[model samples]
Target: MEENIRRNKIVGSRRFSNYFWTIFLFIGGFSFLLAGLSTYLKINLLPFANPTQLAFIPQGLVMIFYGTLSLSFSIYILLTLFWDIGSGYNEYNKLENLVKIVRKGFPGKNREILLTYPLNSIKSIGIKISEGLNPKRIVYLCLKDERKIPLTPVQQPNSISILEEEASDLAKFLDLKLENL
Candidate 1:
C-alpha cells in the first residue's frame, strides 16, 4: 500500500458574478426597498435621527430597525465572502492516505482540516441526500474518539451512493469500521 499520495486539486469557478456580485445585489435590493418605502411616504429618512426629534416615532423606529438589520446582514455577507475567498483551500485529491493536511497561506496556502491517523479515530460518516441545482451533499468523516485529526471534504453535485462508495473505500484502506448511512 502507498504510504503517501499527492492530492489532485479542484479549483472553484472564477466568475465575476460570484460572491462579490451577490453581496452587491443584496445591498442594492436593500437600498431599493428602503428608498421605495421613503418615497411612498415622501419623507427624508436617508440618515438616522434621534427618537425625540423624529416626526413619527413608529415610522422612525421601523426605518432604523430595517436599516440596522440590512447593514448588519450586508457586513456579514462581506465577511463570509472574504473568509471563503481569502482563506479558502481545496482538497489535493479525492482520497489521500496521509498523516496530515496542512494549509499554507493566502494565494498559496490557507487553513486545513486534516486526517492525521490511519486508524482508531473515525466513529461514523453521514452522507447528505438531496436534489437541486446546488445541493449540499457530502460525506462527513466524523470521529467518535478523541480529536486526533479533523478533516472533511465538501463535495459538489453530491450523491449519497457515491459518498457511500468513497467512505467504504476509505474505511477499508484504513482498516476502520464502515458505518454507512
Candidate 2:
C-alpha cells in the first residue's frame, strides 16, 4: 500500500492483498466450521448420510473440534478487519504545536490510541534499512530524549530515495533535522 502525504499529515493504509487474505480466511474458516457443526448436530446435508452409520458419532466429535478451531480463527480475522488493524496515521498540528500518531486496534467504542509529542521534542527523522532475506525499511522520528518512534510501516524492498524523500519531507515540515541512514 502507498502512503498519502499532505501538508499536515501522513496516512498509511494496509495493502489490498492483506485484506484479501483476511477475507479469504474468514470465509474458508466459516465453511469448515459449518461442516463440523453439521456433523455434531447429526443433521447430514450430504446425500451419503445414513442414520445407521456407526462412525457418525466419532466423525461428529472430530468435526466439532476442527470446526471450533477454524471458526475461532475466522472470527478473530473478521474482528480485526472491522477494527481496521494495522492502519495508522501521523499528524502535525501547527496551531496546537503537537505531533500525533494514531494507531488503530481491535474493535471497541474507541479502538485508536493517540500518542502526542511536543513539536520541540522532535529532533530528526531518518530511514532505517535492514537488508537480508527478509528486508525491511522504516522511517523513524528521533526525539531529543533519544527515543526513536517509527513513522512508517515496515516496507518491503525499501528504496533509499523514497525513504529519504519521505523522511526529509517530514523533517522539513516539523522543522527538524534530516538524517539519511
Candidate 3:
C-alpha cells in the first residue's frame, strides 16, 4: 500500500511500481528516440540492415523530425515526474491549531509544496464508500471552502473494513464529525 494512516497523520507515498512504470516509460521513449536519432544521422544501428535498400537523405530528414518530437515529449514527462514524484503527508498539529499537507518531490532538494489551514476550518471527515464488484472507498476532509481533500489512502474492495476503521479513528481523534456518503 502506498498510503500510511497513523494516529497523528495520513500519508500517501508513491509506490515502487509507480517508479518502475515511470522508468519504463523513460526507457521506451529513449529507445524510440535513439532509433530515430541513428536513422537521422544516416547511421544504421539495426542488426538486420540491408544497405542497398537504405534511403538515406529523405528517410534521414523524416527520422530527425520524428526523433526530435519523441525526445522533446519524453524529456517533458521525465522532468515533470522527476520534479513532482515522491511522497506527500497530511498532519494535524493540535497545539498549533493547524492542519498541514506537504508534498515533496526529489529526495532532499527542498522542493516542497505546502498547504496549511486552521484546524477550525476542517468541517468534518467525509467517507465515500462504493461497494460491489469494483468497490472503492475514499476518505476526505470537508473544508469550509467546500473543497474536499483526500484524507486517507483510497481503499480496494477487500480493504473497506480497514479503511472505515481508520477513517473513523481519525474523526474520533480529531474530534470532528464523520459524514458517510
Candidate 1 local lDDT, 81-164, one digit each (tens):
554532323232325433344432223343443335433455654454556776755555556663323233343453566767
In the range 88-110, model 2's lDDT, one tens digit per residue, is 77777766777888887666777
Segments in model 3 whose C-alpha atoms lie over 4 Å from true places: 1-14, 38-42, 47-74, 84-86, 105-111, 129-136, 152-158
Can you give the lDDT of residue 148 in candidate 2?
A: 90
Return the TM-score for each candidate structure: 0.49, 0.69, 0.63
Candidate scoring better on TM-score of 2 and 3? 2
In angstroms, the error of model 2 at 118 is 1.8
For this target, which candidate reaches the highest lDDT against the unseen true structure?
Answer: 2
In candidate 1, stretches whose alpha carbon ends up further than 4 angstroms from where it belongs are 1-3, 6-25, 28-55, 85-98, 101-115, 118-138, 142-157, 172-175
What overall lDDT, based on C-alpha atoms, would model 1 receive against the true structure?
A: 0.48
TM-score of 3: 0.63
Top candidate (TM-score): 2
